[model samples]
Target: MATLDGNLVSADDLLPLALTNLGHFTSMRVDADGSIRGLALHMERLVKDCKAVWGADLDTGRIREYVRQGLDGQSAPCVVRVTVYDPKVDMGHPADADEPHVMVSVRGAGAMPPQPLRAMSIPYERDLPEVKHVGLFGVLHARRAAQLAGFDDALFVGRDGHVSEGGTWNVGFVDESGTVVWPQAPVLPGVTMALLQQHAEHRIATVTVEQAKGMTAAFATNTSIGVRVITAIDETELPDDHPVLSQLRETYLSIPGETL
Candidate 1:
């Protein structure tokens, strides 16, 4: 039902990595015909993060094969997650493993949330902000805490109150004049955000949580949710309907997908 390096494996085998949490991963969705959005960028991300974390060369071809095997005979428009890590070595030194391997899991895609997100800011930042890694203790805790406190998700803010990103998505705002403004801070270079920039007009600026209140509209980006509206960040309510966001959604959807 799942694939580990192109071979069938039980989910139980992955439990071992939970102990070390020394892994990097990328999760993406496959279209009805098994095509992925920004496939090349996704592959590039896997190789780059793997090399950075493990000092090992990860094969994109092998990863593609693994993805194919995982998707075959399964539902179309599915979700695929590829994790790279080493199971051996202590000190959780996965870099010493003979070679880093990827575990690919394919499952039915989830329906996008119907409601817009409401986020509360937390004064925290991720370690190794560039890599899409599996170390999620701090991030997850923040999200949970926010959810329990009455917000939909948590937004990460620096000590200066400058917003960085969301627990799982990249945050973007539209200024009063209809320009896309991405907060200037350390954030994972998300594949969705990367694809969007190629198709939309956006600029980066240093914006604090206090400054976001002045924005006309806001949205969050990720593979799963594409470009989703964020109704509020803390107590700042942004417009739910705006020409900039509508144009952004259309531009993002227009990008043709690539086969793995």
Candidate 2:
């Protein structure tokens, strides 16, 4: 089971449940090889974001301890979620009486696709870009737009008309020099970004427009997807047999659950 609100699930609980309009946020299919991979980093960011956005005093150490206790040696694929929203409004209660609803859940692991993905760009931005909030209506809409365009996922363009990142993942590309270039603009700092940087032969900070125009290859990053190589961006066709993308895909699959 997964940890939620500093507590663990006991198999009697169910998900897809919500009480307030604060919305919901989730992460699933965590690799179960006894290695937390990037759990600590993710928890750190979550705590920081929560405090900054919600004035919540979340303890990262306690959160990790809950996860460790709940993990309890079950090595199957696991799903975990932490959501904050309004539970119920207390009529006539003080305005500050609203409690922030939160929960964590985990389940056995599942399969993750390893194929290189093709993506199209969408125009959207998060109202609170700093916090990874449960509110994801814009992201859902963008994903729907990608589906309409015959793509599996969507890349997001910011207000400045520059490529920011994916609606649900971060973007990285290989320049002509074979250096891995990624954006450092108002984008979410992803745990996968750190992993890729450690593994890449070369890494640099760059924007999406520069990458779309001249990148030799590209990919999306996230804990859920790990790394999804981009086969095409907009209408520009990259060579189907690009070696750089192929190598990244192969290397990515070597990680337990993320396989093609």
Candidate 3:
């Protein structure tokens, strides 16, 4: 189900986004009680991205209202995505657009696959690494190429040959010393990653592909998956069941969700 600006959305309301695909969004898993983990982070992301993408200010309270209206008091766990875009804005004159409208879409919750993921590192970088924008063509293309190459997903490597992130997720590594290491590169600051960092002892450093390969284990973090072990990158194999990775996942899931 979907709503636009707290009202039921129609096809006309989505035409601009479908055509231009210029917007930013944040996804979250909402419990049956309308609560979500890192809810404030998500709101901050939306507000920040709105300013970056459209130079507009967004109210978190209004976003919460729209989300609740979209959920419609359903007592079932689901995934919710709030998209901010302006239907009246065309690519030719985006700067002339007014405050962006919000679109709240709800769907059934999802979990990571039981099997560990194998990723292929590719030289690619998102246009705006900071915003969770609707520009996903490059991301999906990379993922598809990795899948065709017998891998689960694509791990993005910047031009500098430093490992940055995975398709639709942030990547974390566990070194031989059991230290959690996050790549110090330009990538989306994912909510799940932020939540894990708050509770996990971690350090940020520039991790090249070779450095990542030397790590004992790796994992992917996103709103939908929370945390999932990455068993391999390129030809290098990592421990799928590393105790440190398990502890990090547990620490992430243990975070309490805030009520909407």
lDDT of 1 by residue, 1-260 (tens): 76677777665657657777878999897877778888999999998997788787877988888888888788877789998877564554444665677788877776653368899988889999999999999899999999998999999998777999999999999998789999999999999999999888889999988888688988999887788898988887777888888788888777888987
Q: Which residue segments of model 3 deviate by more than 4 Å? A: 73-75, 112-114
Runs with alpha carbons beyond 4 Å of true place in candidate 1: 92-95, 112-114
TM-score of each: 0.95, 0.77, 0.96
Measured by TM-score, the strongest candidate is 3
Ranking of models by lDDT: 3, 1, 2
RMSD to native, candidate 3? 1.3
Winning candidate number (lDDT)? 3
TM-score-sorted candidate list, best first = 3, 1, 2
State each candidate's clash count.
Answer: 0, 5, 0
lDDT of 2 by residue, 164-223 (tens): 788878888877877777776677777777666656676556465645757887788776
lDDT of 3 at 17: 94
Candidate-wise lDDT, in order = 0.85, 0.64, 0.91
For model 1 the local lDDT of residue 99 reads 63
lDDT of 1 at 247: 87
